[model samples]
Target: MNALRAACLALALVFCCTPPAWGEGFALNEWSARGVALANGLVGRADDVSTLAYNAAGITRLPGTHVMGGLAFIAPSGSVETRRADGTRSTAAKPNTWTAPHAYISHQLNDTVWLGMGVFSRFGLGNSYSGNWPGRYNMYDVGVQTISFVPTLALKLNEMFSVSAGLDIMHGHMYLGTKIPTVAAGTFRRFDNDMQLEGDGWGVGAHLGLHMRLNEQWSVGLSYKSQVTMHLTGDVKFDWHGDNLARRQAHLPEARDCDAEATLQLPDSLALGVAFKPLDNLSFEAGATWTRWSTYNALNIYMKDYDAISNKEWRDGWNFNASVEYRPLDWWALRAGFFYETPVVNEDYADFIVPTNGRKTLSLGMGFTWNNWALDLAYAHVWVNSTDYGSTGASGIRNIGITGGRSKNVSADICMFSLSYAF
Candidate 1:
């Protein structure tokens, strides 16, 4: 590759591999205000445009043509404090708030068929620390984002059962910044130099869903989202700080156009849910989701001159969620939900890049409908379990020359709003 292309490739890879803000693992669940209010347990009660994301098969419950749009605001707060062997301490800065948006449209085709499409961010993360933070060697900052477009078709076999399938087209981007450690001249101590990389890529996947109405008041749903592997090509560059400890002169020439490619596999997921409606205006649902996080054991980067792999060793994890909806008036509804998720990363692999562990979330929402237009709003809070990364752990920066640390007070607040119109 040319010098310019190589430099871009290197930087892109660094960007693509940073930590993102979302669920316990890397999965993103804020597709719509309704979905967030229900903790994403809408598989069995997909009566609106949001069904295009949770369970396409539920589209059979909608009438005419429906369109919906949503936006989510996420604010993450926490601190990673490094406790050196001698008892000194240092802390990393918190990340800023971020926004994720989504849109969906669906049309009922005759009595037995429906067509729909959805566009949204399926996964993302971003975090940053002070330039001179103690954990700079491990990570300074990272940002990664992904978007997916899914066109779906739902087939109603009968009044009680339906099936749906969709084609997934996804795009992604990444940027990473960090300080590389270098030995000081005439001394054994190490100093830091800045490094940055960025890149973008595309991938394809599939979505499948099934919905079954067992009785007038009970329903069950199942859905699967396939994994997508993004192959990103980008350039890299590094600044040597103009220090020449070896020759008491200028540092080595800047490295540019270092061509590289990284293959990132987004996890596959399966969700099952049951919904109950005992009264005319009240409905409830309980659901579980399983994500194949183990597939992301490492990040493999291929460069023209060499190759590298960042070990992750993530394990599969499960999420349990429950939600309730009450509609006392034809134009108004209330919603609430709760969920718990297990951590995918162990202390062995935990670091400043992704300090998340197990967590629980609670959500509240309200809706208003008039004529063919509707508005929905929701708020959610996530409580994260704190963890300590001591020097004795086999994983983390301690094993790779960076000081060990602990992540505490890790949590996030989310707000979402959606508007829907029917024709």
Candidate 2:
């Protein structure tokens, strides 16, 4: 009991202090170092406590209590270039590093039941550009952070099948900053005011999982997560950059700070995987995940006597991965994997907030086990296809000026480390 309490406290502190970086459409897949090294191919091979986040039903395979904790470090880089009749200009996103933390515990009870708990991030994003960039009117800075807690119960229906259900309790935080233009004395100025919105909220959902041992050498797994909605209430503040005379002559009214509210509809996902073990020292797995991103159709913010609306029109996305593990010795394992994610954002609704397209990742790592302790380490590099923006004339957001730009050289690097103990 004391150990459980301590683990919970540590997870909470880490989540509160660190923000997660961008992943595939802001969805994080680095819940465990082994999962990262395998490109999240563990859905069918959930042999560790980290399975709490992937497929809780797999916990039925364990006989004793198991605990695992880990952190993922992410660094992303990209640049946006705008071409206009006047000239060509390029601006790069500010350098930044972000971290995502995860923890899980699973215990088997009796012969047919298992209990598990996990704390991790499912969705998050952080991006910042120069304040005076060409796309400043669209977005200068933006960040979204979320953490989820899941307590699950798994029941073995028979020797060949196991099923699990869990509740998802999540907390979310958001921040957005943009430049507002003003017309002063019949002259149009690029920017004269700054607007920032900050908010936090809580949401609840559920998930289910199934694991099937078809034969001695083959197994299958399936998992599903329900959609969640968060209603955020926060403050919107505007800072006037123009002098008194300019402010008075401006055509736009001087807006006052006010309380605001918004609703965010997170997506639901389904994953399926198959694993094959041909040899005692080698195993392979393949998996795919589908996300219902269409649920995120729009972004709306309501305030006193004002309203802001943006049309997202995002489409569903998919991720496919394959992984292999080779254990040359009884105490060490080598792992390699790769995954590709389809684009979710429509070109017609492209914005500066998420500046990439379809992405691919390659990863490799190693794990060591000694007695009751295990250590895992992994590294991955992400490559994002260059995306062209501004041709659609639709800036997604109403009243925001269109800055035709092309986002290129977008990429990221991730490092993961974790420790686990079994009793």
Candidate 3:
């Protein structure tokens, strides 16, 4: 029991400090190199162990025991310039880059059954701004990361149909920092307000999938992942640092700790896809995904000493993808894909910390196979649309005159590499 407690404490500390990068609207689609190259169209054409992630039912196609490991590097660049009421502007530097890795293993029990497990990152983000920025009151830095463990079972009932289900156990972590205004002798001045919250929780969800083979040349897939609500409990530390006069005037304590808790509602998603093979060595796939992002409209922070809310005002979104692959030689294959994602946040809800926008991506990749070992490499370039932030912003509390925003541009590049083995 003592060792278990110690291990739990260590994990909480690690969760509070690590940083990871996620894409716009807190979505991560790059699970494997082959999936990335196909723009995540694998819902109907799962040819490897990674299929356990997109559509477990496809696992029936695996003939034996298989294992896969992969890594994704996300490099993002953007600039946010805050415009004060006085017409002055301040530009925030780019945030740090992020890298995520994933692994999966699957075993075929017989002609009708298969089992698999996977560990991977599903969502993550990090943004930190320099001091003295006009929008410091809204946010100076923030980070969030979510990791998941999934166990799946697949059943092949007949030659043309299959079904699968998986259980998702997700662990999440979050951190936030900002500066508040201090009042002294009827004068308003800037003061540092640093707060750190550390915690971990378990959320349960499920994935269901159906794969149908219409004929030898055509197939379609349908899949759904249930939403999860995580209740996270932890400790919160709030510290106020400034001149003695400022601290005294604000009537605040130097530092304090309190019990904290929050509820995080993750979105549920649905996907539909079709695959076609026109030649012995060529294949194409197209798919679409719909996410109920509107469910994540707020992050309500509850503490024994204080309460706060972060409004997201997000909307549902759709993603479209198309991809093709051709094998010119017995040992090598080439692939290319295109994808487009609708915006989830509008100008009024956009913030420096969670800069969201619509985007389009182009991807290219290649794979090589030798005996039971295969290697895949892929690259994607994302183009983001420019956005303007003004009076309509989500930063301020209930209601206040203090509003600071700006125009912004965000773009990113992703590279993924994976190795798989079948025995």
Candidate 4:
């Protein structure tokens, strides 16, 4: 690799590896619909047809003809709270999230060659809190979103081997809507609504996967995705939602807002999968996945015209995922899986916008294949076993408050659908 690529790799590791603002340990679980269903069961195997997005090596197993494509819908949720010195409690309203759609397409060139491309969101989550939220004076607002495009290729070494790789051409946008509190004359009414800031940038990255068939009834696979960095730009403004739009506006900070960007920690990941046929007509499989999130030690924001913030523990935790699938016939398949993620932030940095913590998830899905056409659907419900934390000083704000909240709760629900075709 050259200096350009080397520098990019380093930057990607520094920036891209930061986990999403919210998630069970910040794991990026946006691989594919079939993947979400089987909970990533194609680690080192192939379906000999559609759904190869889970394993590039498996694309080479495309039975005879070759080509695949499909899409999915995703939703994200979260909340933050505050505790005052007077034992008073205040909470922010969690945002009801709506994300863009995604799709993937792949092709088999021959018995030993395959190619694919995917336009999907590796991470695009937003956390919105109500304006008059109880913590409006102590903690007010937060929001962010990101997306990427991946092109891939795979080669079948022989009847029992194959490999695939991808380049993550990532593009993204980040919008921060929050409140900067200040007090004067021993009164706190000055703690009003600030405004929102938006920024955007671009970056490049890559990934690789390998597969092997040990025997007719056994197979294993491994895959890795490299993270990418984005340099964002946009206008900085403070729209006082105060009763009078104008009379209450000019009090907002006046920013020159020329060139500025938000740094995000996009984490990389590794997954291992296995498949076996314990019964003549029954095919069973499982998978395990890991994400690199240690890079996110803080939420550091820089502005072209203002001071930045230093938020610690933004990058602290590990996510563990496992899934099982059973195929009883050539035309049908079923799947179920589970996950446990370590908390990403200590009690100190936790807030209403990113109420993310350790969580548990349950998933179920299946697909029907008919010659060159197929339809796949999956449903998953994640219950983050609730947790409580005491002041740890990791958060620059939340703690030392006079009147507020000091408890947190986090959970999620994931629903998806896909219709694909292969010729």
Which prediction has the highest TM-score against the true structure?
Answer: 1
Q: Output the lDDT of residue 241, model 4.
A: 35
lDDT of 4 by residue, 1-423 (tens): 132122222222223223343355434464555766766565755664333445667777665454444444445544444555655554545656544455666776777777777666666555555766654432344444556677888888988888888787887766555444433223334654354456567778886878888888898878777756555555545443335534333333221122344566566777777877666555557666666666655544444334344455554455556666667788888877766667665555444334555676777898788987877778776665433435444222443353334444455566776676766
lDDT of 3 by residue, 1-423 (tens): 232222223223222323225354677778899989999879988668888778878888888899999998888777666555567565655556777788889999999999999777777777777765666655667777777788999998998999999998888877666554433334454355555556677788988889987777788888888897877888755565344644544533333345556677778999888999888799999999998888877666654444556556678888899999999998999999998988876556555565556788899999999999999999998887655666454433113343555546667789999999999
**Alpha-carbon TM-score of each model against the true structure:** 0.90, 0.89, 0.87, 0.80
Candidate 3 Cα RMSD after full superposition onto the native fold (Å): 6.2
Q: Between 2 and 3, whose lDDT is larger?
A: 2
Model 2, 327-370: lDDT tens digits are 99999999999999998877776665667678999999999999
Model 2: worst 10 consecutive residues (lDDT sum): 10-19
Q: Which stretches of candidate 3 lie over 4 Å from their true place?
A: 1-24, 88-90, 183-190, 238-255, 305-311, 391-393, 396-404
Model 3 alpha-carbon miss at residue 92, Å = 3.9
* Lowest lDDT 10-residue stretch of candidate 3: 1-10
Local distance difference test, each candidate: 0.79, 0.79, 0.73, 0.57
Top lDDT model:
1
Candidate 2 residue 262 Cα shift, in angstroms, is 1.3
